[model samples]
Target: MLTEDFIGRVVIVLVVTVLTTFGAIHLFVTFQQETSASSLAVVTRTGTIAFMVLQLVMTVWRLPPKGTARGIESRVTSVAGTFLILVAAFLIPAVDSETVQVTALCLIFVGTVSSFFCLYWLGRSFSIMATARKLVTSGPYSIVRHPLYVCEAIFVSGVIISHFSALMVALGVLQFLLQYRRAKNEEAILRQTFPEYHAYERTTPMLIPSLSSLDWR
Candidate 1:
């Protein structure tokens, strides 16, 4: 399981790096452009509905987890992230009306596509339990170890950007931090579970386009 654990840790690192880069870019843009607080309520509501649907599906489907900390932290992050998003959706006013609309569209598209890709990759091996029964190293795992979690970060960030709430943006950053911590713990457990994880780590491209790049191969 070394291959799997190593691959998982590598993917987590990549995801965190990408998020940091994106966060920097987003902050720069938001600072330059004035945001609206009026549309926050509407966007937040729609986002909440979408998030709720996803949560319900995950709950009903129930996937295995890596460890207790990973499992518990996942739920906490979800709830906290949801609450922040909801606040932006319901209470914050839209700062830039036109931009807000565009932002929402972009967020929805990116989040949906990323999330669907993760779910498809996870397939039947997906579970929400606190411990994993098997190492998933095919499909998305073959490409990036933790596609679902990576995409989740994307989704959360997208929603925050869609709402254009400064407070929510900060909270989203905190959410990511929490997620990274959880991933760190999960990776340690995965390392203990799998012996082949290191070999896989050397080959996979983490959260980037590993399989996609291989299409030409």
Candidate 2:
């Protein structure tokens, strides 16, 4: 059922997962010199639960119909999004010490707001399983073709900036690249899916929305 691209990406995902996991373990152990492993484990479990719940909700609502597989780029973006969410959720709280207190809180607040907005805007349009859904070219889509992805980047950026670690930084940059690639492919598909999408694309920026672009009518 899986295409070569998907298979290839799955391999990449596995490798990245292992590396990130190792990095996370090392990070914990290194910092465990200062903090308690039990507390960190609690943080990791809590983050995993929260992220999994959010992912479940998104998946149920936004999954595309059967046979509508998005390309490698989109899938990669999805994977990156998942990775960053777990990384931020699990590690950020653990690393939140006196030196990074303000940074961590600010990042969490901003990222949470942005991610919520993304989820709200995506509504029933957020699916990994792939299913048929109406091309959402209004509301947030009217402002930007891919508001959800923009929100995703914003979320990752907030978390990375808050933590300011090598691993988070690497993940954030990779996520941004993947999201951009995915957005491009998604826009191409959108152009075909919606009768009015070309017109919508002409008026709307991809992500950096401006007030003047809105019709407000």
Residue 164 local lDDT, model 1: 68
Model 1, residue 216: displacement in angstroms? 9.9
Top-scoring candidate (TM-score): 2
TM-score of 1: 0.61
Off by over 4 Å in 1: 1-44, 63-96, 124-130, 208-217
Instruction: Report the C-alpha lDDT of model 2 over 6-104, residue by residue, as the tens digit.
Output: 454455446455645655564466455644543443343333344345655555445444234455556666556556545554554444454453444
Q: Could you report the Cα RMSD, in angstroms, for every candidate shown? A: 10.9, 5.8
Q: Would you list the C-alpha lDDT of every candidate in the order shown?
A: 0.54, 0.56
